[model samples]
Structures are given as C-alpha cells and as structure tokens.
Target: MMTLALQRLQNTFGYDSFRPPQDQVIEALLAGRDALVLMPTGGGKSLCYQLPALVRDGVGVVVSPLIALMEDQVRALSLLGIRAAFLNSTLDTESAWQVEGALRKGELDLLYIAPERLLQPRTLELLHHCRIALFAIDEAHCVSQWGHDFRPEYLKLSALHEQFPAVPRIALTATADARTRQEIIHRLGLEQAEVFVRGFDRPNIRYRITQKQNARSQLKRFLETEHPNDAGIVYCLSRRKVEETAQWLSDQGWTALPYHAGLSAEVRQAHQHRFLTEEGVVVVATIAFGMGIDKPNVRFVAHLDLPKSVEAYYQETGRAGRDGEPADAWMVYGLQDVIFLRQMLEGSDAGPEQKRIERQRLEAMLGLCEITTCRRQSLLAYFGESEHPPCGNCDTCLDPVETWDGTEAARKALSAVYRTGQRFGVSYVIDVLLGKTTEKVTANGHDRLSTFGIGTDLDLKAWRSLFRQLVARGLLEVDTEGYGALRLSAACRPLLKGEVCLELRQDKRQSGGRRRQVSTDQRLTLPQRELWEALRGLRRELAEQQDVPPYVIFHDATLLEMVQRQPGSLGQLAQVSGVGKSKLERYGDAFLEVLQAHRGDAADL
Candidate 1:
C-alpha cells in the first residue's frame, strides 16, 4: 500500500515524498481509520486525502466550503489527468446531473461539494449508493462557535459519523486553538480518530508590525521596496477602506482591485478570478475576501489596519508564500484600533464569556505587535505550542527594539487621565497634557490641574506612542461600554507614584519611503533569462488556451528547474520535480520544443 501511494504520488501528483504527518494521516485513512489533522496552510493537507482516494477503491468525497476553491482544486486535478468534479450552486442542473451520473458510475477519483449541499437529504441519498471513498472535511475550524469564521452549517457535520460509520473520515484545518481543537473533535464525533497536532509554524513568512503612521504611505513604501512585482493581498477592516485603498493603489500604478461582501456576487467572483489567474494583482478586501483562496505565489499579505484576532492574522498571512518562498506578513496598527475594536466588541450581541474570550484574543494580537522578542515564538505559544525557538526572520529578531525608561512620561500620562476624571477621549486627554488650552480643556477646568502641561517634554506623536504602549501594558484601559474614553487602570498606581519603573518602546521610523537592501528576484544570466521568459510565455499561452490559471499548467518553480536543467528529451524532462507522467505525456512536446529552441539560441550566441 505504501509503495502504491508513493507511485501514485510520483506518477500523478509529481511529488517525490510526503511532508511530515501527511504520510501518517494518509496511511491511517487508507486503513479505514478516522483522523483529525492540523497542518499549516500549504502543508500538503489536500494530498493526505487526495492520494488515498485515488489508491482506494472509490471516489474521495471532499467537503469544501467555497465554490471557487472546489473549482480550482478540480481544475488542477484535471491538468494532472485525474478524474475530478465538483457539485456546487455554480453548476447548471444538467452539469450537476452529469457529475452525479459520473459519481454513480465510479468514474471520478474525487468529488468536491459544500457542506450545505452535502447535508441535504437528496445529496445524502445520492452518496449512499455511490462507491464511497473516505470523507475529507476542509476548513474544519468553522465548527467552533466562538471562532471568527463560524458557520452554523458546520455544526451538523457530526451526522457524517452516524450516517457513514464504515467510511473513514478526516477533518483538517490550519487555524484551530486548543478550545477550537476540542470542539472540532467533539462536534465532529471523532473521539476515536487519531489527532495529529502538527505544529502551526510557517517560518518562510517574515512577521513585521509597525505603528500606523500614515498607513497608506507606510504600505506604499513596504510594497514598493519588498514586493514590487509580486501578487499580494491588502486587508482592511472596513468595506469603504477596501474600496479606497484599492483605488489608491491602482492610482499609484498597481493592478489593484477591491473585494468585500458588499460587492455583488458577480463582481466578487470576477475580482477573485482575476486575482487568482492574473499576475501581480493586488486585491484590497475586508475579512470577507480570503477564506478558501488557494492561489500560491503571493509574495506578501499586508494589513493596513489591525486584525480583530490573532487567528485571523495567521490564516490571512498564511495565504502568502504557500509555495515555500520568502514572503512577508506585514501590519500597521494604532491606539484608535484598540479603542475601536473594544467598542465594537461591546456593541456585539454575544454573551459575557464570549466577549471576554474575544477581548483576550484582541489583546493578545496587540501584545504580539508590542513584544520585543521574536514574534513567531509568541504566535506559536498562543496556538498552544509553547517551546518553539526564536525565529530570526521577524522584524524584532532582524532589528532589535530599543526601549527607554518611560516611568516619568507614563506617570504624567496616567496622572493627567486620572485628573481629567477619565471621561475624555485619548486625543482630548493628550491635549490637556500637552497644554493645548483649548476651549473644552478650559471649560472642564483641566488647565488648572497640576498634571496639566506636565507631559510637555514629549511631542504629540511621542506622547501618543507612549500612551498606546501604556495601554498595551495594561496600565490603562479603554472604556468599552461607554464612549471611547481613556481610563486609569489599577495597574497604573505604582507607575503613577514613581515607586516602580516602566520601559517603553522608542518610536523610530523613516521620515519617508525607503528602498530594499537587495531585490529578491534571483539573478539569471543572459541565456538563462531569455530561456526563462520563453518557458513562461509558453506556459501562459497554454494556460490561456485551456482557460485555467497559468500555475495550473506549470508553476514557476517547475519552469525555473527547466531553465537550469535544460532537458533535451521527454525522458530527461520527467526528472524535474513537478513533472509527472500525466503532464509529461500531455504538455511534454511543447515544452521540449521551447527548451530545444532556447538551447540552440544559446549555442549560436
């Protein structure tokens, strides 16, 4: 069985070996055992179920959440010469019947469908008669009630166990914490299944969080330097912001587009399609955009505003560098983000416990940005992996943060907040401290207070940065139930009295945009460069002919290998990493022709 699995992997999927827990998970599923798998994004989770279904006697029934995801998987599978199809709302009735007919005839190797469709009585009846392979549940974290991506329909997935007791079931996700993990096992009735807690760490992605100083300007600099020619996603917290950012980026000469739930279904689908199939397209979107998107080659994921939770940040950033290249998870946030999120949480309809959990999650996210040590370690610890070593790739690790004795400034800020009755907002309180003497300050008699003008040593930006750090340290609190007011916390007493010392991060940044140390685009010699473009052109032309994404034809990694190896025959070409028998037999001659022509040109030169 293991030999057959490896053979199918090589001859069909064109991979050499399994990536850690994938082989074990597949082995269990092939033996008719239930399994719960937690692998990071791009961790070969799909292959865990995909290979078993092909090797086993029946078609693998995959429960997917989104139509675009299903279509993408099916198309990529078809290119690999696997018989795959999807049953979704996007298909016409005739097309759906054809898929159902194929399923009954045991002609498909895999079938993808949404949970809503899978749970339907009609769909259940159809599956009952088919030669059922194991069931693969993707994005299984949606079952958690407190999760940001909660879907009520997912709660009913437990029925899969009762209905198909003999069918091996595997649940998989990349972003489940301890609570959500337990919920997945219990709610999915996978008590007896083997649970694989493959650690959540994507080291290739560099984490960088900066204070939001002119978010657009910072983002522009980050993009212009780090990922000038790469595809990426810019996430915003609001729909209006998504539109504005997308337009702003396009105006700056990037192929930018907007996507959110507010857009019509057609527009969203079209925008997502362009993003997936085109090169160097930046999609600015709210949280509604990136759940099941499978496009690799995204060089970065930038957040113009703070994410509501750490899990969302991880999952969203996981979209970049899926192909194991160096990518960035960059974000910018500020004090207002904290207040805005707190008030938004207070306005929610959730119960107290839920709200508390969410509040802690938000605080954890803020705390992550302010940490002076490696961020990857902190992120792993949050997901229950506590012993992770420091990742030297993050901003903190690359450039150590400088801290200073902020006790005096913190004392003055806290004293001012307390003296002002803790009723005013952050800006107004800062005004009182900076001795603005505005009408509101004088009317409130704050100008006459002893703490007034006590914080004049620091400028406005400096004070704002100090106050934000104080809030993050729990010395201050934002009023969630009331208006966005600054309040003194019990933790501030010692610092306010000068009995204890406080150290805060020093604000340091470039006054304007900056350049990269070196471009990441690998340098190719003259011959190699010409050959590289030729191969890509061929791949793009073939992809257009077939109406699929260019990567589906051949990933850039594969083409780069072609450029170096300069294979002269089909037999030699088969040695490339991603070259399988299906692709070799299908597109081998065309690629071989291009390669031969490039070789001739190089020889003539």
Candidate 2:
C-alpha cells in the first residue's frame, strides 16, 4: 500500500519523494487512522490528504470553510486530472444538484463541501451511500474559541465522527498555538490521532516593522523599489480605510481593489476573482481578506494598522510567498495605533476571562514590535516553537537597531505624564515636554511644570517613539475609558525612582536613504529575461482561455526551474518539479516550445 502511495506521488503528483512528516501523515490515513496536522501555509498541506484519497478505496470528503479555497483547490486538482467537485452556496441550483448526483454515484475522487452543507441531513444521507476514503478538515483552527478566528459552525463538526464512525479523518491548519491545539484536539475528539506539529517559521518572508510616518508614500516607495510588478495584499484596520487606500493606490496608477464586509457580496467576490486571476494586483482590505488565500506569488503583505495578536499577524502575513519565494511582511504602526487597539478591545462585549486572554495576546503583539531582537525567533516563540535559530531576515537582524541610554529621557517622559495631572493624551503631554505654549497647554498651566522644556533636546518624532515604547514596555498604560490619556503603571515606579535604568532603540529620522532595502534579486540575464516574459505571456494566455488563475497551470517556482534548467524535451520538462503526468502531457509541449526558442535565441547570442 505504501509502495503504491509512493508511486502515485511520483507519477501522479510529479514528486520524487515525500517531505518529512507529510509521508507520516499520509501513512497514518492510509492505514485507517486519524491525524491532526499543524503545518505552515505553503508547506504542502493539501497533498497529505489528497494523495491518500487517491490511494485509498473511495472519494475524499474535504470540509473547507471558504468557497474560494474550495474552488482554488478543485481547479488545481482538475489540472492534474483528478475528479474533484465542490458544493457551495456560490454554485447554481443545477450545479449543486449535479455535484450531489456525482457524489451519490461515487464519481468524485474528492468532494469539497462547506461545514454547514455537510452537516445537513440530506448531505449526510448522500454521504452514507458512497465509500469515503477520509475526511480532511482544512483550516481546523476555526474550531478553537480561543483562536483569533472562531466559528460556531466548526464547534459542531464533532458530528463527523459520530456520523461516520469507521472512516478515517484528518484535521489541518497552518497556524495554531498550544492553547488552540488543545482546543482542537478536545473539540474534534482527535486525542488518539497522530498529531504532526511542523515548524511555523516561514523563512522566505522578511519581517520589517517601522513606525507609521506617511504610510501611503512609504508603501509606494516600497512597492516601486521592492515589488514593482508583483502581486500583494495591503491590510488596513477599518472598512473606510480600506476603500480610501485602495482608491488612493488606484489613483497613483496601480491595479488596487477594496475588500471588506461593508461591500456587497457580489462586489467582494468580483474583486477577489480579479485579484486571483490577474497579476500585479494589490488588494487593500481589512482582516476579512486573507484567510485561506492560496495565491503563491504574493510578494508582500503590508499592514497599515496593527493586528490584534501575533496569530492574526502571522496568518495574515503568511498569505504572502506561499511558493517559498522571497517575500516581505512589512508593517507601519504608531502610538495612536496602540491606543486605538486598546480602546477597541476594551469596548468589546467578550466576558472578563476572554478579555484577559485577548489583552495578553495584544500585549504580546506590542512587545513583538518593540523588541530589538530576532523577530522570527520571538514570533515562533509566541506559537510555542522556541527552538529555532536566528532567521537573520527581519528588520533588526539585517540592519541591527541601535540603542541609547535613555534613563533620563524615560524619567522625563514619565514625569511629564504625571505632572500634567495624567489626564491628557500623547499630543498634549508632548506639548508640555517641549514647553510649547499651545493655547490648551497654557490654559491648563502645564507650561509651568518642572518637566517643561526638558525634552527640547529631541524632536517630535523621537518623543513619540519614546512614548510608544513606554506603552509597549508597560511603564505607561493608555486609559481605555478616557481619550487616550497616559497613566504610569506600577511597573514604572522603580524606573521613576531611579532604581532601574532604561535603554531604547534610537528612532532616527528618515533621510534620503531611509530604511536599508535588501537589493532585489536579479537572477535573469538579458536572454533569460526575454524567455521569462514569453513564458509568462504564454501562461497568461492559457489561464485567460480557461478562466482560471495562472498558478493552476504551474507555480512561479516551476517556471523558474524551467528557465534555469532549460529543459529541451518533454521528458526533460517532466523532471521539473510541479510537472505531473497530466500536466506534462497537457502543458509540456507548449512550455517545451518556449524553452526551445529561448535556447535558440541564447545560442545566437
């Protein structure tokens, strides 16, 4: 059975071997067992269940949460000649009926259905008539109430075991911490199942977090310099901001779209479709935009606002570079962002215990931005994977942050907050520090405070950075009920008494040089560039004809391999990764022609 599985892996999926625990997970399912898989976003989670479905007795029943995820997977499977179908609300009545009929006849090798549809009695009756190879639950993290994404529908998925007691099942997700993992196990009754916890580190993505100073122009420069023609996602905190940013990018001559819950479902679906099918398109959206996005070539994910937790940030940024190419997780945040998030969290309707947990998560996110260490290390540690070495790809690792002895500066900043009656926000406090006789400051008599004019040594940006860092360090807490007023925390007493010292990252002003940019990789020569363009043009042509995303034909990785290896024959083309028998036979000839022409051109040169 294992030999046949390996043969199918090579012949059907066009891979020489299995990536470590993928083989383990597949083996468990093939042996009539269950599994709980925690793999990274681009870590080939699909194949673990997909190949077993083919090797086992009957069709695979995959429960996918998103219609887009289901459609993307089914279309990619169809390219490989797999009999795949999906039943979702997006389907017309006739289409849904046809899919149901197909499932009844045992015609689908894999059937992707939403959780609600699968839970319906009519759907269960249909499933009872067919032989099911296994049940694969994608995005299983939704089952956890503690997770950032909590779906009540997922809480009812435990019925799959009760309904089909004998069939094997596999639950999969890309991001889950210790708490969420236990929640999934207990909820899904997968305690006896083999649990595979793969590393959560996406080494290909470079993490960069800087303060927000003119976020729009900063994003533009990053785009023009780092990702001139790449597809990406820019996340904002609000629906109105999403619209404004998307329209602004469009006005600046980019293909940008707005996506949020505020838009009509049709508009949201249409924008998502265009973003998937087209190249060099950027979608500015709220957190509603990135779950289960399978686009492998997103070059960057920029955050105009801070996410609520590390998991949200990790999962959102994980949407980029799914093909394992070099990508960026860039963000710009300020003290106002901190205040805004605190106010939002405090105003939520969650119970006290839940609110406490969320507050810890929020503080952890702030700590990640403020820490002057390896970001990947801290991020993985948050997910309870602390054994990784320094990734050397984040902002601090590449261009190390410089720290200054700011004990006096910290004391002065703290004193200014205290002497001003602790009733004012950051701007008013800064005015008192700089001794600016703003009408409000003078009216309040704060201009006569002893801390006045003490901060003239530093500029406005430095003062803001210091205060943000103070809030991050818990030395100062934002008054959630009031209008973003600062209050010194109990943790600040020792520092205020001069019993402890403080060091802070020096917030340097941006010059013409700005942040150090990792020079973009230049792999293609003059001849290779022409061939690359021709190959991409051919891919776009074929994808448009089929009305599917270009990646379904071949990922950017496979095409780069084609350009580098210069495959001459169909047999040689088949050796490139991602070229299975069906794809080799379907697309091999055309890609081979392009490669052959490129070789001819290079020979002439």
Candidate 3:
C-alpha cells in the first residue's frame, strides 16, 4: 500500500520523493491516526492529506476557510488530473447538487467546502451517507480567538470529530504561536493527534524594516530596486490608502491594482484575476487581499504600515517566496503606527484578558523591529524556538545598524513632552525642541522655556527616530483619546533622572535604490532563453483559453525544468517535477512543438 502511494505520487503529482515530514504525515493518516500539522505556507501541507485521499478508499473532505482559496486549490488539482470539486456560495443550487451527487457516488477524490457550509444540517446528513476517507481542516488557527485571522465559524469544526469519529482527521495551519497552537488543538478536539511543529523561519525572505521618512518615495524606491518587473504585494493599513497607492504606482508606470473589502465583489474578483494571471502586476491592498491568494511567484511583500503582531507580520510576509526562490519582506513604518494600533486595540470590544494578550503580542512585534540582533533569531524566539544562529539574509546581518548613547537626548525629549504640558503630538514637541519658529510654538510661548532649543544637535529625522524608539520601548505612551498626544510613561522616570541610559540605532540617511546584482534570466543560454519565452507564451495562451491562472496550468519551476531539460517527448516531460500525467497528455505535445520550433531556429543559426 505504501508503494502504491509512492507510485501515485510520481504518476499523479510528478514528484519522486516527499518533502520532509510529508511521508510521515501521510503514513500516520493512512494508519488511521489523526494529525496536527504546523507546516509553513508553501510547505506542501495539501499533499499530506491529498495523497492519503488518493491512496485510501473514499473521498477526502477538506474544511477550508475562504471560497477563493478553495476554488484555487480545486482548479490547481484538476490540472493535475485529480477529480476535485468545491462547494460554496459560488456554486448555484444545481452545481452544488452535482458536486454532492459525485460525493455520494464515490466519483470524487477530494471535496472542499467552507466550515459554515459543512456544519449545516443538510450537508452533514449528506456526508453521513457517503464513504468519507478522512477530514482535513485547513487554516486551523482560525479556530483560535487569539489568532490574527480567527473566524467564528471555525469554532464549529469540532463537530466533524463528533460525527465522523471513525474517520481520521488532520488539522493544518501556516501561522500559530504557543497560545494559538493550544487553542487549535483544544477547539478542534485533536488531543489524540500527533503534533508536527516544523520550524517557523523563512530564510529565503530577506527581512528589511526601515523608519518611514517619505513613505510613498520609500516604497517607490524599494519597488524599483529589488522587485522591478516582478510580481509582489504592497499592504496598506486602509482602503483609501490602497486605492491611492495603487493609482500612484500605476501612474509611475507599474502594473498596479487595488484590493480591499471596500471594493464590489465583481471589481475585486477582476482585480484578483489580473493579479493571478498577469506577470509583473503589483497589488496594493489591505490585509484582506492575501488570505485567498495562492499565487506562488510573488517576489516580495511590502508593508506600508505596522502589523498588529509578529504573527500577523510573519503570516503576511510568508506569502512571498512560496516557490522557495529569493524574495524580500520590506516595510517602512514610524511612530504614528504604534499609536494608531494601540488606540484601535484599546477601543475594540474585546475583553480585558484578550486585550492584555494582544498588547503583549504587539510589544513583542515592536521589539522585533527594534532589536539589533538577527531579525530571524528574534522572530523564531518569539514563536518559542531558539535553534537558529545569525541568518545573513536580514537587514541587520547584511548592513548592521550603528547605535549611539541617547541618554541626554532622551531626557531632553521627555522634558519637552512634560514642559509642553504632555499634550502635544510628536511633531509639535520636536519643533519646540529644535527651536523652530513655527506659529504653533510661538503662539504657545514654548520658545521662552529653558528646554526649548536644547536638542538642536539632531535633525528632524533623527528626532523622529528617537521618539519612535521611545514609544516602542515603553518610555512613552500615546494619548489615543487626545488625538495622538504624547504622554510620558512611568518607565521614563529612570531615564529622565539619569538613572538609566538609552542606546538607540543611529538614523541613517535614506539612499537611492540599488540595482539587483543577479537575475533569473541570466541563468539561461540564448537558446534556452528563446525556449523559455516560447514555453511561457504557450502557458499564458492556454490559461486564457481555460480561464484559469497560468500557475494552475504549470508553475514556473516546472517550466524552468522543461526549458533546461528540453524534453523531446511526453515521457521525458512527465518526469518534470510538476508535470502530472493528465497535464502531460493534455498539453505536453503543444509545449514540445514550441520547443522543437525553438531548437530548429537555433540549429539554423
């Protein structure tokens, strides 16, 4: 039976071996044991359950979180010649009935539906009549109230355990901390399942966090430097910002699009389609845009604002480099982001305990940004692991920041906040400290104070960095109710009294964008380049005809393999990593013809 599973892996998925721990997971499920898989995104979580469903006797039922994710998965699986279908609001009653009928008749290998739809009485009754091989719950962290993407409907998923007690179940998620992990296990009733805690580090992604000086120009510089002519995602904090930034990027000659909850369904779908199908399109969006995105070629993920926690930041940035290629997770944020997030947390309807936990998480995230050590080390430590050394990929390791003793500057800034009545915002306080003759400072008569003009040694950008560091370190607090006024926290008392010293990173001047030193296109010979483009052109044409994303036809990795190998026939092409048997039969000849044409042209030369 295990040999049969291996054969299925090669024949159906076109891979000769399993990624680490995948075979163990498949073995566990095949042996009638449940599993709790904590693999990262793009870690082959789907194969753990999908392979078992194929080798086992009945249909595998997957409880997915989003309609778009489910649809994308089904389309991708279908391209591999698997009989997969999804049941959700996207399907009409007639189409829904057809999928259900296929399930009852044992004509489907896998069936995906939303958790809300699965918990309905009719759906449960229908499933009870069919032979269910197993239950797979994706995005299992959604069951935890503490998780960033928690969905209330996920709470009802334990019903699968109660009703289908005989069927093996597997719960999987890409992001979950200690608390979120336990909550997932408790809520999903997976106490008996074997826990797989894969490491949380994404070493391929180069983490870069910069203090915002000019956000629009900073983002423009980053896009131009690291990700030119590549697909990426730029996350804003608001819908209006998403729209404005998308338009601005488009005006700057990038293929940019906007996505958020504010757009109509049709418009959102169209934009998402273009993002998926078209290469080099950058999607400027809020956090809502990424949960359903299965595009694997996103070269970078840029955050225009601070995420609420390390988990949120990790999950959003994990969307990049899904193909295990080099990618970037770049962000530009400032003091106001900290205040805005804190204000939102305080004003939310969550209970005191929840709020406290969230506050702790936010502090941890801030600490990650401010740490002088390796960013990967701090991030992994936050998730309760510490096996890694300094990763040379992050900004801290690439170009280490310089630190200066800011003891006197800290006291001056703190005193400025106090002398100004602890009611002014950062800009106003900085102006008074810098001895600016602005009307606000002159009207308030702050120029006459002894603390005024006391800290002219640092420039405006340096002052801003000091304020942001002070806020992040808990030496200062934002008066959310007073419209972001600066308030000195008790933590600053020691610093103000010279009892403590603050060592802060020296603010570096923002430089022009640097050109990328390496390019993927440089790997190919002239002949191979011609063949690569021809293969890509064929894939794009087929995607347009089939009305599916080009990746659903074949991923770039698979095409790259084809170009390098120059397979002359279907048998050789079938040996490629992502070329399953069905796809080989359907489109292999067309691609081979293109390859042949390219070969002929090169020979004539």
| TM-score-best of 1 and 2 | 1
As a whole number from 0 to 100, the lDDT of residue 328 in candidate 3 is 88
Query: Per-residue lDDT tens digits of candidate 3, residues 80-172?
Result: 888999999989999998998899899999999998899999999999999998999988888989778889999988898999999999999
Worst 10 residues of 1 by lDDT: 512-521
**Per-residue alpha-carbon lDDT of model 1 for 1-605, expressed as tens digits?**
87899999999978788889889998999999999999888787889999999999999999987776678779999989899999999999999999999999999999999999999999999999998889999999989998878888889999988999999999999998888899999999999999997879998888889888899999888888777778999999999999999999999999999999899888988898888888899999998888877777888899988888888899899998887777889899898887788788878999999999998888898889888888999999999889988888888887788999888888888888888998888899899888999999999888999988877889999999988888777788888766778888888887766689987888787444232323223557878888888998898888888878888888777888898899999999999988999999999999999999987877887
What is the Å distance of residue 221 in model 2 from its true position? 1.3
Report the Cα lDDT for candidate 1: 0.88
TM-score of 1: 0.97
Looking at candidate 3, the ten consecutive residues that score lowest on lDDT are 512-521
The alpha-carbon root-mean-square deviation between model 2 and the true structure, to one decimal in Å, is: 1.9
lDDT (C-alpha, whole model) for all candidates:
0.88, 0.88, 0.88
lDDT of 3: 0.88
Assess every candidate by TM-score.
Answer: 0.97, 0.96, 0.97
